[model samples]
Target: MVLSMGIKVGITDTTFARVDMASVAVKKLNEMTSKVQIIRYTVPGMKDLPVACKKLIEEQGCEIVLALGMPGGKDKDKVCAHEASQGLMMAQLMTNKHIIEVFVHEDEAKDGKELDWLAKRRAVEHAENIYYMLFDQKYLEKQAGMGLREGFEDVGPAKR
Candidate 1:
């Protein structure tokens, strides 16, 4: 929907335990969309991210950072997942110029089966609340404008 609307989107998959295929998908999106920027991740270290993000800005001229927070497991993993997500948020906050957005999925059952419709609906509602907690229009607009200035020429209307 973002792409269709012409918004340049950059994706970061901070899925715990292992990187997922969505990272690859976002990279490919960079190729397909003139406005997209795909950032590479560096191993978490004391000073690596700040240095790496500087380079990403200097080299790729990236403006916004979106962090995807998929957990390694189910509810039992919430503590670790929350910590990881918080760490990423703190890092992004430290970077004064880049706007950060975090996406977190709802806890799933151990069996990893598809959620029933009601459960899915609740998850969607919860995710919406989470997004509100994490960001507001001012921040989003700043990120969107920065993205456009950086190289995301395709300006998309806000997603409904």
Candidate 2:
């Protein structure tokens, strides 16, 4: 059954990313469930995501936010990513909501193709996560401590 009225999930992306992760995530969400109303806002860089997300949640009625970013493989970029992360956390605290951070660092991939793959995969996987957070908390609860990684393969729970 398709839901006509439901939660609004916000996507705050960065233009600094080499790949368009936001679009990939939006596609994934649409494919996964008809219950979500997706709202997107683009910023110039990772550091700008917090405000954009805050606006999406406070002004656009987003119940949860996905902050997608790609920090370059540089020392400064890494610092910026950390700052952005802190800001995202603060936003979550201030708004009393969840802001799922999906960051694919440039250094995490060895090449252009790998970077693209990582970005897209992370976005899609996180989209699935938000779906669970919104509609199926039990599913997530069941998978707790399962070592789930968004962009990479799941490392399932350790053997007893």
Tell me, by lDDT, which candidate is best: 2
Candidate 2: where are CA atoms >4 Å away? 1-5
Model 1 TM: 0.41
RMSD of each: 11.5, 2.2
Worst 10 residues of 1 by lDDT: 145-154
Score each candidate by Cα lDDT: 0.41, 0.94
How far does residue 46 in candidate 1 sit from its true spot (Å)?
15
lDDT of 1 by residue, 1-160 (tens): 3444333333344324233423444544444444444565543421233444444544555555444444444565566556655555565666554534333344443333332322333323333322333345564455554322111134654555
Clashes of each: 0, 0
- Write the residue-wise lDDT of candidate 2 on 54-103 in tens digits: 99999999999999999999999999999999999999999998999999
